[model samples]
Target: MRSLLVTGGAGFIGANFVRLWARERPADRITVLDALTYAGNRANLANVKAELVVGDIRDEALVDQLLASREVDTIVHFAAESHVDRSISGPDAFVETNVVGTHALLKAARRAWLGDGARRPHRFHHISTDEVYGTLGPEDPPFTETTPYAPNSPYSASKAASDHLVRAYHHTFGLETTTSNCSNNYGPFQFPEKLIPLFLLNALEGRPLPIYGDGMQVRDWLHVEDHCRGIMAVIDRGRPGETYNIGGGAELPNLVVIDTLCRAIDDAFAADPSLTRRFPDAPAARGLPTASLKTFVADRPGHDRRYAIDCSKARDELGYAPRHDFASGFAQTVAWYLANEPWWRAIRDGSYRAAA
Candidate 1:
């Protein structure tokens, strides 16, 4: 935890992690390696000060250069092609970045950390998603670390492959590594593609809030801050070769989340009345509630019915538990978006679909 090379550090969770680290670990030297794709916005990291290296994770020369030059003791690998909808549309980029790019990172880290007998004690922490366990039946228990990998979509399959590579590096090559499969994360600096921010911004602008299928697809919604804390717990105290499931303990279907978010926006809007002028087109400003914008669309192919994580290992072993309850976190999230309209507007207004 002395010097860190954080890949995808300009993206959602990575940016949040980098910002938190800069504040909490001011003594640590943190460098960000990001391709600055549509998802990886430099503005996400604008408020914080960190060394930013603009490059792709698959660039072996660049990865190796940073590893050697920085003497990085830890690598928090968050670089991946993560949007499920995009993966459904174009799986090639997902395979290339998630699988091939991860391999490049593992190879570079292994050579630099373990090869030539330098034997520098190091850590490679992979951030993954619970979707790798596939969808669960209504009655099935939450996925645990031992849950079989049953990825349902191209996105999850690619991530599953990367998870395996990290484990293989630890077992075969003896690279010190840890991984955490987290649930849905919603908080500040999130690009407006995923559900929360997308819905919030869309509803704010009077656009249709598209719900896949019946809007009943269940997700375990973990606040981004909580997810970041869980990752830090794993990086600080996790045993090598172990996988931890990080969850926020807030499980609900998509429709319920939308209703909650809409109401939160309503309250936030009432408090900050000027939002009527900011997102002036919002239906709520015209006496129509934000939730009226809901419109169900064809579901994603192979949409997971439900996802839950059994993170008891993280709780019992790593002393981890979510601090913000769903209500508080959700309220704060809506409020943050209300306050930071310009930040997301810059992203939402453009063709921000370029892959990271």
Candidate 2:
């Protein structure tokens, strides 16, 4: 695509996608539209050379204006309210942003870009999560592209609704669209509220590492860079009106993941013992030690037990393969958080703290 519109480009995955696309194809023009919510940060795109538009995706007039004025042929939509815990506490924002906002963007895209007979070249790529498939039993196979959506939480339900809207727009209105449902993403620039980064940051800061329920919930972790590459593959080669499952194929239990993080943190501190004294007053840094900070909390309502994706469709169709194994990806991720404290520190101590 020559000129593209990236919604939620300041958010974690969106920002990574923007950075990747910008680096991979420097000649292409990009315009980022983000609401700058708690999860969205302009610093994520500090080095990007694309145009940055700070606005909500729900603004029909603004979305239309951008699509028309920028001559955007491709729209990579990544905007959504993603946290399940936040959704439980306040679901209205999820409905408004994920469902209604997607509708508005679809309408605007149809009106502004597809109004003419020049149709085949235009595309709308929707980035979604695998939670739409609900929890999977240990004996069950991974979720494939054909899996029926059985969303349990408000967040997943809202994403499922948005997916349906994208499909409807393609079938009824003939809007060229592609949807990709991805597994859990963990990598650089992720907000600290997420499981990996939360535990990592909390462990580093000598705070309690909270684990919901018994911490056996399983998630298939995909590196954010791999996810961005998968999205690029889908946007470039995926057939319109098709849904692809993008997965890292690495599944681990929640508690196992936490323990892995603890070990990583221990090694990190051992490499530089001075870090232990950096936070003198924190309990995790004091008598209790890091591993002892693990605290199991009451699970939230409707928490999914397991989610895994069958991404053979993407691998077979788009020639997409994840290069980083879990160990490598997790190391890179942990290093990023350790190296870039200022980026996540503001969010951790600011408005995003409530979600944490």
Candidate 3:
């Protein structure tokens, strides 16, 4: 069996990718390494059969040991401190995990897979975000692979630093590397801190749905499954040292997405009488309804106004096509949250927080 190492395989997108890949390639030996940080919940990988290694990526000895002993031939790195608000509050962890951790992983990979800068059939695939392109105006075209790096927040800055390191290793030490910057991903297993899940969970709980600024911030939404498919495509067939931009082409303003979620939640509850009684304290109970719960909040510091992606490169090169549009993806995601209350309730009730 081909041995594969997946870093941050317990987090949202990472966990989804792990589950999908495990099912698709059942014979492949999959090893997962995660720090189990506040956002990295092992429960997200409950259905996956990969060998779990609960540890930080910065642990050089552990990483090196895993690579050498496990005979890991391919590394798909998804580990990082990804929250923009949290990054603003605590930039130190972001730098440590995103920049330093990436460096440590590259160093360990070099030692384990190379001898005097010689080539290996093995590969390193770095997963990143389009926020590294910085903010765009309303009229600006979507970002492409060649867009200049102009990261606006600590989170994006850290990712940019990691991207640079990956490129340097590929060029200087001849490491076979490919990097992909994807648009925002929404689907099951996403933590509630993000916009989509946050609103969904809050709407269900009858809590205030906070909308930052005027809620006009534009973002491209890709289903986690589609994003995972794009990553696998890059792993299987992408050119070394090249960057691919993966997007679902479902771009919309934040307010629009919020409204859509409100409608979906209302319809879901209306369809199922059991949900109405299960969430008795919900806004639907107070007659305020999901749409009435929306409350605009102050904008975050250094908030990017727009982020769009030009995914033609991925489509042309990898034959990548997203299967779910925002409507279908959002419906499925909201339904997942409704069906799996225990998964997110633990996250909200301080149980997971205490463990972290």
Candidate 4:
């Protein structure tokens, strides 16, 4: 069985990837390294069977130890300061983690895997964002792997730097590497700070669902599961030193997503009367449309106008296709949040961090 070390495996998309990998490759030994940051909750992996090492990725010594001790053949680097707002407010942390932390991992991998006279068989798959390609105009085509990066936000800029580092390691050290720049992802175990989860939770508590600007900004939404699947395909079949773009094929404006989410919540309450009791404060609980809670606010600085990914490369090369449509995916997301109130509630009230 191949041993794999997943960095940031306790975070939202990372946790989802870990769970998927465990289920799909039962024989593979999985090790997770996370700093247990605010977004990286250990509880996110409560049901998944894997070794969890609570440490920062910037710790090069620790990474080298894990690489040598575990005899890890694959490294899925997912750790990053991902939130745009957080990066805007504090770019230092983003640079330190995304750029510096990634470099540390690369160095450790190079020392452990390539230090010997003979080259080793290993893969370093870096997870990145389409935001690195910057905003698109209304009539612009979706971003491709060949698109020249024009990162606007600090978070995306940091990710762009890390991507370049991964590429550099491949060309300079002959380290086998690949990168996947994915569109927006939404699914279970997501931190509530993101748009979908944050709005969902806010609506449940009678709080206004804040929409930035005109909410016309468009994005291609990829289901986290599909993204994990795409990653697996890349690890298994993709050529070394190449990049793939994974997208859900669900490109819609932010307003449309919010409207759909609101309608989904309303439908959930209507279908299950018990939801009214559970989330009594919700507009749906009072027989009012969940859309009643929408409150448009001022847009954040440097907000990207649009982001779309052209996944034709992945589709043709790796037979990768997103299985979840926005409708079914959004419905499931709403249902997940409803069924796991305690999980998100802990996060919302700051109890999860305290308990951690």
Candidate 5:
């Protein structure tokens, strides 16, 4: 059985990955190392069968201890500051977490697995974002695995640096490493700072749904579960020192996504009258359209106009394909948010952090 150490396993994508991995690979031992920051909530991994180590990834000593104690043979590095606007407003945290934290993990992995000319069966999988390829013009082709790095924002730039570090470690130290740069992932446990959950929560609370600029910015929306599956595929079959692009195969503008989310909420309320009582503040409860809440706001700096990924390499090499289509995925996501009010409500009211 493989012993896996998953960094940031309490955060959105990492938690989903942990849950999926635990469920699918029941025999494998899973140990989670998370800092449990504002974005990384312990509640996200409520009932997962894994050892949760609440610690920063930057602490190489701590990482080394975890590796030695857990006998970890695989390290899935997902710990990073991922918010674009937060990176724009304050970039120091992003640099420290994404770049520095990743380096620490690489160093610890090298020390534990490659020190003293000793080699073990191990894999280091790094999760990254497609934004590192920069924006695409309206008529441009999608970003492929071979796309040149042109990160525009601090968050993406830090991720690019981390990706380079992963590559360097693989090439110089002969570490078994693979990287997957995925498109936007949306599903359960996502913080409201992101577009989908933010707009959904705002519409439910009768607040303005702020649309940045004209909201024409396009993105590929990969369901978080699909992303987890893609990651699993890479770990199971991909070659070391290779980079794979994992995409949802659904590219749409931000406006379209918001509109669809609003409609999904409306449909849910119509299908179940009790939803009106559950979310009384929702515009749908008042027999009004959720679209009414949408309002344009000034765009943030370095907002990419479009991001699309071509995962042909992953498809050909690992036989990986996304299972969740946009419509069904959005419906499932809406249902989750509607059902898990308390989970998100705690975050909104500052209680989750207090509980931590």
Candidate 6:
């Protein structure tokens, strides 16, 4: 995999992957094509030196042109409408971007490499989510590579459709493809919609930390950097037409995770009590910890109770293992948001909001 095309490289995981891959493999040239939606930030790639194309994945002409013009040997597809709550509110964008957009990329790839024999290793690595496997019971084992996809929400359902499409293209047309279903990812450059970033921002600002249902939904949290390494591993060593589960082994309930965050926030505040002034609306922090701000909110509809990954295939086959433990990773993540205030503050100020 030399010349590469990374779709959605402006987003959280994609941006991290782009920066990491560039740093690690300086010889390779990466071209990124992103639609730059609400969560997609150009600032995420501030330091990343690569050819950035602001276009939709569904644009067949653009997809084909980039693949062929750049002699792209690998396509690391990360473009998708990925927020579950946003999907619950409006699902059309999910289907359009996740399902139809994937189809467009696959078609373009098939056409781009129809009879070209120059490219030695042509690969399409589709990034996916564990939500495609639906919720798991408390006693049920974690989802393996072979877990049947039973997506519960519009987001996961759309992603499952895209996964199936990739599989079909690989089998029917012999497109070299590998898919990975990963657990929850949290780290730098993440938008405020996700659990960790949202809660972290709210806690830091002394706002009410909303907990859905009992806040007991279990998720295997993978740091964005670890997830990127797992992805690179699959692209380098994975067998074509196979699926891999990339898990962090950091399984924790939502409530417990938030408690950890609370402690981290408290620690940060204990060091500097004047930090509360950053948020104009935040209550004064005499010595109060953020955990006291917890407030229960109505649970989301069709909310999965648990989502975990086995990831043995990735560990044994690709020699992949997550480096970040939950405790330290969680702390580092909090510290990143604390230090990168300008990054998140722009989003908080409505600079990246979708146009009317």
Q: Which is the leading candidate under lDDT?
A: 5
Q: What lDDT tens digits, residue by residue, belong to model 6 across residues 172-233?
A: 98899999999999999998989999988887676788999999999999999999999999
lDDT of each: 0.91, 0.90, 0.92, 0.94, 0.95, 0.90
lDDT of 4 at 323: 95
Tens digit per residue, CA lDDT, model 3, 1-356: 67889999989999998999999999998999999988888788886889889899999999989998889999999999999999999999999999999999999988887866665569999999999999899999999999999999999999999999999999998889999999999999998999999988888888899999999999999999999999999999999999999998999999999999988888877788887888876776555568998999999999999999999999999999899988888889988998899999999986865654
TM-scores of the candidates are: 0.97, 0.95, 0.97, 0.99, 0.99, 0.96
TM-score, structure 2 vs. true: 0.95
lDDT of 4 by residue, 1-356 (tens): 88999999999999999999999889999999999889989889997889999999999989999998999999999999999999989999999999999999999989878897767789999999999999999999999999999999999999999999999999999889999999999999999899999999988899999899999999999999999999999999999999999999999999999999888888888899998988899998999999999999999999999999999999999999999998888888888988898899888888888745
Angstrom error of the Cα, residue 279, model 6: value is 4.2
Q: RMSD for each model, in Å, please?
A: 1.8, 2.4, 1.3, 0.9, 0.8, 1.9
| Lowest-sum lDDT 10-residue window in model 2 | 279-288
As a TM-score, model 5 comes out at 0.99
Candidate 2 residue runs with Cα over 4 Å from true position = 116-120, 281-289, 351-356
Measured on C-alpha atoms, candidate 5 has an lDDT of 0.95
Worst 10 residues of 3 by lDDT: 280-289
Measured with C-alpha atoms, the lDDT of residue 210 in candidate 5 is 90
Poorest 10 consecutive residues of model 1 by lDDT?
347-356
Q: How high is the lDDT of residue 327 in model 3?
A: 86
Q: Write the per-residue lDDT of candidate 2 for residues 1-356, one digit (tens) a residue.
A: 48999999988999999999999999999999998888888888987988889899999999989998998999999999999999999999999999999999999999876677656368899999999999999989999989999999999999999999999999999999999999999999987778999888877776788889999999999999999999999999999999999999899999998999888877776676666777564344554457788999999899999999999999999999998899999999988887887777778768443432
For model 6 the local lDDT of residue 241 reads: 99
lDDT of 5 by residue, 204-314 (tens): 899999999999999999999999999999999999999999999999999999999888889888999998988898999999999999999999888899999999999
